[model samples]
Target chain A: MKDVSEMYIPTYDDVLEAHERIAPYIHRTPVLTSSYFNELTGAELFFKCENFQKAGAFKVRGASNAVFGLSEEDAAKGVCTHSSGNHALSLSYAAGRRGIPCNVVMPRTAPEAKKAAVRGYGGIITECEPSTTSREEVFAEVQAKTGGDFVHPYNDPRVIAGQGTCSREFMEQTGGVDMMVAPIGGGGMISGTCLTLSNIAPEVQIIASEPEQADDAYRSFKAGHIIADDAPETIADGLKVPLKERTWHFVSNYVSDILTASEQEIIDAMKLTWQRMKIVMEPSCAVPLATILKNKEKFAGKRVGVIVTGGNVDLDKLPWMLN
Target chain B: MKDVSEMYIPTYDDVLEAHERIAPYIHRTPVLTSSYFNELTGAELFFKCENFQKAGAFKVRGASNAVFGLSEEDAAKGVCTHSSGNHALSLSYAAGRRGIPCNVVMPRTAPEAKKAAVRGYGGIITECEPSTTSREEVFAEVQAKTGGDFVHPYNDPRVIAGQGTCSREFMEQTGGVDMMVAPIGGGGMISGTCLTLSNIAPEVQIIASEPEQADDAYRSFKAGHIIADDAPETIADGLKVPLKERTWHFVSNYVSDILTASEQEIIDAMKLTWQRMKIVMEPSCAVPLATILKNKEKFAGKRVGVIVTGGNVDLDKLPWMLN
Candidate 1:
């Protein structure tokens, strides 16, 4: 078990600093209210549409902040990172804007669409086998070759602070929400959300919605320990990463509960978003909606906020999954 | 052929008035830009996302304006209309908010999802066979039975005036686009777009895009005569209607040309929009994009504004179409 107090959790001031640092580079994505969902679930639901954010995900905020916050000398050498998809695209886009080279170490099995997006944004891709050992070795080799700074996807304090800007915008848009439910990946988004909410609206309950298939975050929350071994497979490719030390601290201290939704429930919610809301959402982005649908009684008649994290998905795989 | 000069073409003043009248009732949908499409088509595209409009279409603007523009006596008696889908949902939603009854005549072959949306918004539906004869007969029967005021989907001067408000917002957002392309059905949207553009930015070339099978507007534009006898058979359900007298007058005078796109082109465009733009658009709404993709040379390197008119397609039918 990792001591949470020893972990580098971002403070409210850090989030505020991140907001100022990334404001010029990142988009202020809209907060949309759903009248239909409000009526269906008997809850006032405000969706922080991070699906509209740059790189088609909330990852851009953190990536841009981390990349730009680098010292001029370090930034001149450029940056490198390993990602399944969105984080790579985000870093690529952010780096492109600054005219810096970005090297992305991606699993060989990463979706072609994601690989294409990363390349399209001017990132160099170095594909490796889908395992932690291969990822580390490949990243190290790439770093040795390029002399680029390595930006950890979620573990870094700068990254967590950058993601916290989403909750800052959410609080500003809705005045204040009673509770917030966000999908937990490597715990970047939830940690940032919790940090911001704890400072601005401490009364607000921050809930983590995770896929039951990849239940590391849920298990860790329950056991009050970081559980990283034997992570199960899930359709939510974005939420597969085990929580890091820094993010686990914030999740432990600020998150009210970590709830799990079945793979079927996530797919169903994704389909509902496509059909009813007419919005394109990936399986990972559907976690909050799936969580609310599964446990409607808890959210009923309350002012709740959901972060639709991203919209990047493989179109070829969607129909088969839905069926 | 009906004389276009005798038809009641709405002016910019009429649109401005409608905008003022419906300001409190309707939402001003956002104008979204795409850098990806710009690179692909060699055109800077500004998509006026009416898919995000109230009731998920621009029909709400016309419906709200028409309903509120009515006499107190007429409004109290309520309103009625016949539509394949979008207008029915929009009218029902607008009427529901006004605390007035709305009766909709829809084709029996209409998608169940659309029927559900209309009913969900408190509309009374009267289904008939899917044909002009059946539509007219059913609409007349409903009007005779209910004694409710009729709000024609596109042909009415007020409806055209109301639809023009979309263009007013589009111009305000993009500021002097070189060209504007919109889907033409009964010519409501294009008629309104043309009229508004003529006054605000007269130099802007107004182009109407229709499905190849449902190209009455295209034929009419070429022949200098209204062609109402074109047998409709296209994926763009919204572009099935032949241009009415009032719409023909505005479209004939203000529009530069009417282009046609194949059904396959529309489907492909819809798929691309879903995958790239992360926005769900009905086949009818894809006409402008289809036109651009099919005839890239014509639109390339131009500042083109494409009105994504709606996003109200049946999800079940999407897979079958893609297959």
Candidate 2:
């Protein structure tokens, strides 16, 4: 096994550079402190609301940093990616700002709203079957056809560095947090968070929250092995991806623990955010709150930070968990 | 009418002082810019999202300033008000912070969600019949019983001064927008907006948007007389109040126009905000957007600022709005 510390981990300087690169392109989403949520869970919770971030998710931070970091000639060549939702929107928005053409390979089963948002931001979409085989096959065909540079959603070092920028901002906004929890989906956000926290505030415990149904990261972290699954079923559609080689190394080394929450808990937290905070959060974004609610004893009376990943849920399809 | 130009209009300096007075007690709600809205309206639209403000409305800005500006002895005596919804929640939250009791006289027809929010913030509710006579009668009885100071929702000079803080923040963020529009209920928001714009950005046009069914402000502004109706029908529950004396003087002098939008237009804008901006806004908050959409020619290609007043709509009641 490769020594995890030797793996590609972003330094504080790298994150600072990424922040500077994306400063003009992306919004520094505010950290909203919820006294209502604190009273309910007995923890001082600072919700890093990336739901209000540009392109409606933290994905924009990484996508903007990567696209802007590219040379003018390379950017003119354009960018390509395969994503079911938020990543596609971010890449499309980032590319739109630079007037670069973006092609996204999205699963046919992806929500219409997600597809509309991607196209709305000027990304050309090609529908593929809902499997790894189909995504890679379709992406390769599109890459060959368009000659666009492929941007991996999570595995790329640049993308990880970009994701670290969110944590850097989080720490700056909130002087120093004792613990930070973020939802693990494709391991992109968590990997960046881990890398950034490891350098800036090594004492701050970094915890990963995953949907129990899609517990590949939790299982992999526990067993100290790369766990790849053909398919996973969870309402957190973003977390369906198993950890890739680059992300797996960072998670194993820097993440203190990976906690799992039930699908019902995710839905409940989503409803709670909507009702109490009046913020429309998607199910995947609610995983951190779900983990905190389920394991209150672990976080009681502590200044804990939770990343609310996104707010792209369809109004017509709110989860039945509230009822 | 007593030389409107010489009327007591709050200065930018006064707004600055109010901001400082209420800074600790009030939230600095984020200013959300919508590219989608800009594309749709052909205007660079900045939504001063008071929906995300504390107590879910801009009322908290005024309520906090009013309550906190009181002497320590006066604060200890508590505060009372008669409001259909938002002001009640704002007063409750502000009073709760001071550890003082609040008595809210509300119509029995008030929404359950609002009532629950008021109670959640530790407010005492006094239910009254849904009429001006009943509301006044009940409020007088409550004031006589509790000896609490009456923090008039929109009529009080302190309340109007409090609302001015929003425009002060807006001017600082956007730096001299071409036009500013806010919904007109009893004109607390617009009155404050006009005062702030008059002092800071004197060249900016101040427009007031009102629901057609509740166009008392429009009528009154045109005829140069107070228009008081026994009852008005509108889904914009927030705009039911007739113009008060202090607000009337400001609106009469500083407001460029009072535009009216149909209930359907307001509902459409509400839906569009939810679908496109991913922000929850009530009918009253949507009035400005609705007016802009309905009269596109007037606002087209201009830098427009809209105050999204609040987001306290009941989720269950939304499906019925489609009808």
Candidate 3:
């Protein structure tokens, strides 16, 4: 992996460029509000619904940016990534829209639904063991043979710029929010939030929500340094990744606070979201709402923008149904 | 109960008045479109999402109309209904808005989620045996003791007129649709659709969807008479009730055809809606999509309006997960 200083840190100009480049491929997902949740939280919440994004996640925003930003030659060579979640499918979706190949390195044991999504988006999958080392090793061999352009999921500049556009749209849709909350995994979304809000509305508090089981970004934020676990177990399966250097830069700078929610809380909030809001979102996406419920006093009477990051969930394996 | 001949069938004027009366209480729900489903069915489908309605169903339109249209003297005694589903919760939700007592006689075997929703909406629940005779007997006793104004779930003209407003909004939202499809239970929504479309857009075809297991409307439409079933079992519990004389008038007069889908097909369509559209809607609501898929030749290349009737599904008891 490249050193932290070697990474291309994106700027607001890059976000504007990325938005223009990806305008055709991505969806300007709707902003939804619920009076019931508003009454419960005592805060007027506007949910930036990236769950309805192209590949069922905000990852599509960054993926599309990366795909569209590539030159004709690099695009012809194709794009590659190692992820078992939304990014893998999103990258494929983006690459397919550009009529390019997207090679993905995923664990052999990844959920069938996710694999189907990747395949449906025309991604070529190379199965590896469900370990970081195996993923890296397999991705290296695949990348060497395919000679594809590498797009690091959360650590790349183009991806961050792409994800930042979601907040831009949120502001435009809601006439600007007082504060924003988003789930922090590898910190791509949070970093993008910071990147966008820090420029346009720096006064807005940028809060990050994390699963207690996989609270590396939260711990890192508190420690003023990056701290990643080997593999944390959580129902918020998308949030197992550790924060990379590029994402860490923004999270360490503009993020006001990092909050964590328990696995049960995440599940309950996910169910409540479906039951009351009539929208289907993943467990990882509910982290922000779970945190709000935990820290109700902090957000009371504020117009809060909650980024619902994704909706790629295994309907058959919903957490509430499991024994 | 009012006799079939004496019961007033709602007209377009009543629908126009109902729209004005219930405008404050009901939501003019957003019209959603899916390019994916459009490609699959070869029909440009517009979804009127009533799942996001005040109490999570289109029934709220009728319930609110009934409650709000009542005189101060009649409304003072409160409203009562015998339903184990959306209508019960919708009545409670409407009653809560007016701070009036809403008595709901629900079946003892109703799902816990429905029961909780009724309670959440501030309905007074009185349980009865899971039989029409017992429901009528218990509701009669409750009505006699409380002397509450009876609001028949679908048979009442006010409720039918209220549901008609959704179609009016649909035309306004989409300019106009070539055809409209909705699930037919007691034919309230379908009747409402007929009432509005028959007057405003006489050329638009109105279609009724039904579960094959409970295809009384489909059978009756072809037979040119109303057929009442004692009990019919389907995963779409909301579509079990047969059409009343009041609704039958509109269904028989205006509906072009009544289509039906098997239980498994309904379940598959419901899951597909959740998986692809990323929206939580009940099995009953999937009937329209199922019929669209089955009769694609008929609707191909047409702009079809699909009324997503409700979103009140038991999260734990999803049909795909059942044994």
Error of 1 at A158 (Å): 2.5
All models, DockQ values?
A: 0.49, 0.35, 0.86
Worst 10 residues of 1 chain A by lDDT: A1-10
Q: Which ten residues in a row have the lowest lDDT in candidate 1 chain B?
A: B1-10
In the range B15-113, model 2's lDDT, one tens digit per residue, is: 777899899977777778877788788888889989888888999988987788778997889999999799999999999998999999998887788
Model 3's CAPRI class is: high
TM-score of chain A of 3: 0.97
lDDT of 2 by residue, A1-323 (tens): 11223455556676788889899987788788877789988999998988888888889988887788788887888999998689999999999998999999998877777888899899999999877678889999999999886778888777888999998999999998889999996799988998898888899999999999989888888789988776688888888877888888789888998899998988888767776777777889899999999999999989998998887766665665235
Candidate 2 ranges with C-alpha deviation above 4 Å: A1-20, A65-78, A137-147, A320-323, B1-21, B69-77, B129-134, B144-147, B199-201, B275-278, B300-303, B319-321
**What value does DockQ give for candidate 2?**
0.35
Give every collision pair in model 3: none
lDDT of 3 by residue, B77-121 (tens): 999999859999999999999999999999887778899999998
Model 3 chain B TM at: 0.97
Candidate 2 vs 3: which has more DockQ: 3
Which prediction has more favorable DockQ, 1 or 3? 3
Steric clash pairs (candidate 1): B42-B301
